[model samples]
Target chain A: MEVKEPKRRIPLVGILSGMISVASHLFRKPVTVQYPEVRPYEPERFRFRISLKLDDCVGCTLCEQVCPNGSIKMEKLVRENPRNKRMLYPDVNFGTCTVCRNCEEICPTTAIYLTHEFETARTKNSFLYSPLELAMDEKEVKK
Target chain B: MNDQWIELNIGPQHPSMHGVLRLKAKLDGEIIRELEPVIGYLHRNAEKLCEMGFYCDNLIYFDRMDYVGAMNMEVGYLEAAEKILGVPPPDRAKWIRVIIAELSRIAAHLVWAGAYGLDLGMLTPFFYCFAEREKILTIFTEACGSRQETNYMSIGGVYQDFNDKIIQEIKDFLETFPKRLEEIYNLYVKNDVFLSRTKGIGVLSKEVAIAYGVTGPMLRASGVEYDVRRAEPYLFYDKVNFEIPISHKGDNLARFLVRFEEMRQSLRIIKQGLEKLPEGPYFNPKAKKSMMIRLRGDGEYYARTESSKGEFGVYIVADGGVKPYRVRVRSPTFKNLSILPVLSKDVMLADMIAISGSIDLVFGEIDR
Candidate 1:
């Protein structure tokens, strides 16, 4: 029986090749998009924060049912709708939302949809958006 | 004179252990005498979660299982559901799914390349690999909204259609990615230090790999040409022309080379898919819009996709109900990780990391 040692090959050329290849990248522009300073453009269909179309609400409770994480809660409103006499609207807990867009796709009256506003950083969980804030935003947009 | 052996615990906490993998190795002067692996740290009861949700809702949970290759994970479950419901996706949808799945395969392999380099104390390749991966992730974000953990694929088809801009971006990626891949090969695979560390270490024989049920690059590197894409021919894989790279050595270096070639093959598939993409409705119009889809019949079915890690399989037993009666996920990482003890036996302690890195275990899938 013969015992053989694995052949040892010199790695000088290989090391030099790798070094040169990486060095070439230094001359190219950096790919980093500096956060907070520069906001990357969000696509049209991008699922970010959720928003409500207050006037179009039919109190379907479909968004609440479709949310996989139970992030949407429907509450009874004191003031009723002028046409449909609907009194229920949704309050969203943004903390648990996976942003899968199920609620948006499943909304019959198109009352709920994802907004382009993805930045939801807040100091407290209570500061997260509810139906009231969403309605206020919708009013401001209309004006 | 007396001989003594020391016991060492590698981690459920060590950074290089990949993810929550604990290895108990008995060492005799830096050479491992025995190795035992402990897993199940990141388990979130994936099967049980699947049973609770509607079939469509379970896609979100599958995304979390193999977080790196979420598209591939979703494909496994979607195929299973599609089979059970007797719903074949539209032709256009099938091509789109192939393109997205291959891009995900490239991204997942890039992660492995970066982490494997990190495990070997090389920092340059990690940065290089991630720089390319960022491009793929950006494309994913543009197409699917979320960059990671995207539940984009539904039972009937994809959630949305790719617009011209998205398709053009993919073309741009396809054009630029091959040169970047060559740069990666020069940076890591061709480097002598990498070859020295990985060339002949942790060799698994073809017979052993097959017996242990190791699929994907690991099995291919061991000289077994068992690719589920070629064998099972899912999606438009049969239409694409590509070769399965194989190495007879079955060592760490062979595994690295196999993945290196696999990235090229995935790029080839993407190019063909883009060229032959037809215009049609992305989703099946007859498919119901409800979140809870009710199955028409009660049956048991299994679907497997050739994921970047290995063969990811979903087995569902439906009792003609909205929720499945039983669901089981056969994760590739779990099977690949099982052979660690066999590969690590009698190897130097330093070589252990290389061997484990070659397997590319994602603990989220393994534990689940």
Candidate 2:
């Protein structure tokens, strides 16, 4: 149907929108992003990257995972302790971390806390590094 | 304490305002006698960003310019770079590009459909539109990592390949979901209120539309059937079949109808694309690393395509270098909005909102 211009100005548009906005808004799904309160839904095998703890000093390869996508690679590093003893650390390569956050969650110690930071895209493939070399390591420490 | 000729400012802060859009209206008792649109509020200097970043890094920035049409924006720069390098996408990659581009086009139009209804004072359609749009976005996020500003489209092909779940989701979206959009039209198109507010308001004639270079649904609304998809076929567009919906009224309502009909045609195009889905490699990685192909030193080529809203064109000059010498984008909203003062001149202060809403300017694009 062709719409002809009406000479009469209608005033109910704002009101109609207001009423409908309120009514349908009730039936509408809430897309609110609740941070620090609860974790939102995560799909299984949602691949991102992995984060590892440097303080726990355990060379555990448990993250080789109850396995799915072959994205996890754990490397062992030897660092001398304050007692002049050899301590073992796990170096994680994120080029392979499916970002299931499994490594951070399953670690047996309080030495690691995964920060809620994401979206670090870069031009270089080297930036996909998830090592202590990548996961916010302290260079200029409390010496 | 108001005069017969009331001067009202319909703000860079009003609700109906699309990202800092300001309108100064001269009204004679709710009827607008004159209105002016003020631009530059959301201007973030996106063009300058092009000059600052490397050709590869700049794609990320272009995605944010009019983030809604991120893929189109990415393609715009990639094509300009391709023109400079003189490397063409393989037939398989081109078809994949066209298919995903059309999907993004549909996604962008769904936003317009829902939001236009919101602007017209109907709210239910927005949710319905988003409900359907979410399905498309979900499919996008699954295929690409991000939901909105997906850097999914690489210079040659997609950044990633499609999985079985994504393919099935897209096919299901193509089939099961658009039924909700039908329910929305049935409920609102005949509501009388939506029609009375929108019909015959802000009529852009064919001559004016052509003169202003108004492409897309707005131009089609004036009975000028020129779609970049058909007029200048690129990618796999030549391989598929679709129709451009045109209306003769050229009024706000006519533009609305044009887009509604267009969604139908887009669905047809998507269906055709799926049935004829040929198998092959999505991306030709070799298209990226070759520094041998460079654009002509002194030639200028203008590429225009039918975006969800209107014709989006990119004009780039080659200094015979890898990156463009000078790039200026002719965004659809930037041009379609120029006719605002003409349309709003004799409208009511309240009606000015409807008029501007019909024009559908995105500040990201307008400011860029």
Candidate 3:
């Protein structure tokens, strides 16, 4: 690594160009989107809160095993499926979840998926979704 | 020791400061005499946690390590893990990794540019830079599931393939970003105030930078033609043709120019990568689920990737077990930050903010 001499540029020209750049943007449409009324574009794979489909779940326990932060815990559920012998489903603790998508990736079935709902805030301190609560569809999760 | 010296502490909380960095500076008549960076505020003991989990489970920690450049961080860790496992990702995956890594570099640089502007008492550029960054984040969201902490890269390959929609999105970004980048560049770089605040400020000499183990754009700005992507030739970097931009100034202005040039190079790399992207399976399916859960390897390997900040290297000491025996991260910001004391001497108190911002300190990576 060797040092070379620095280049000299006209400060006046730079300032004028910068001013022109800023001025040009004044005529263009503002990039900011008004929230609550105008929703920003979220891609198809936009991940946020965890949603579970009880009908497709088979109590594989893979989601629980793959959760890095212990956010997902397997609980005994009364609902039984032909594939599920133990009748277990995942209970997601959103308070600890980093939304890393590990559980979704490891799931044997596409039962556990991430919803595109960005607004997961609640008045309560912690968000603990039980087996039945986690089974909410996209529409219910949105609500 | 002199009574004339006044001790000042600027953040673990401050509006202008980047992240949760706390700077303890000793000032004498508005000039900084001595400075020490107080870290560990954002520490999660990530290295220690990596030792407790399975190999695949630890990738998320890398995502959090450098949250802005999560893709690059993941690449570093996975490269080392894959080396030990002796399973290489498919050609398409390698190309995809390159594209994602370069995009992350651009995004991280955009943040640094924005935050740097904000530190220098300019607000408009911050908004402008972030607006540009939002588009890149959308690309990440489409490729991975998350935007900032994208846990996209996986061992033996990436988690998902780039769909045509995602490719089109990237192409759209590529088509529009350069012109927008020029506008943003002209908005700040050529401005009299920005230049005066940055030029010839916090000059890190070549010897001092090398001595302090500085890497990435900081090192490049000091006239070091070293890039891990080029030097190590990881993935498809050797296949791509791009110049390593360097400046001998080693000052804040030089760093800004270097980063701007690097972004252009990154755009070129992404364009080339998209063109050369092969058609194949993204992941090496041979690396089974059981293998991922309980990976057993007996070796120590260190892999380095040029993150947006600098060289984000990961050292893994694996035993014949499910978990790694030890994982050590060579986070670039940590080493780059070590030179703060060297650069801060005899500089104005206000200039201290400019200097620190130029270094692009991320406490998550540093404190980890």
Best by lDDT: 3
Docking band of candidate 1: acceptable
Tell me the tens digit of each residue's lDDT in model 1 across B1-368: 11577899999999889889999989999888889999888888989988887777788888888888889998889888888877778999999999999999999999999999998988888887898998888888888788888788877888888999898989999999899888887677667788889988999999999999998899988988888998998888899998888888899988888898899889999999999999998887545465335445369998888999999898999899877889999999999999999999899988999899989988878998
Q: lDDT of each model, Cα atoms only?
A: 0.83, 0.65, 0.86
> Chain B TM-score, candidate 2?
0.93
Q: Which regions of candidate 3 are displaced past 4 Å? A: A1-13, A138-143, B288-291
What's the CA error at residue B290 for candidate 1, in Å?
2.9
**Higher-TM-score candidate among 2 and 3?**
3
Worst window of 10 by summed lDDT in candidate 3 chain B: B286-295
The weakest ten consecutive residues by lDDT in model 2 chain B span B288-297
Model 1, residue B204: distance off in Å is 0.5
Candidate 2 local lDDT, B277-358, one digit each (tens): 6678776555433222212334566777677768887776666665556777878888888888887877776567777777
Q: Considering only chain A, what is the TM-score of each predicted structure? A: 0.80, 0.45, 0.80
Candidate 1 runs further than 4 Å off: A1-10, A82-86, A136-143, B1-3, B291-297
Clashing pairs in 2: A48-A98, A49-A99, A71-A96, B32-B347, B32-B348, B84-B294, B84-B295
Report the lDDT of model 1 for residue B45: 93
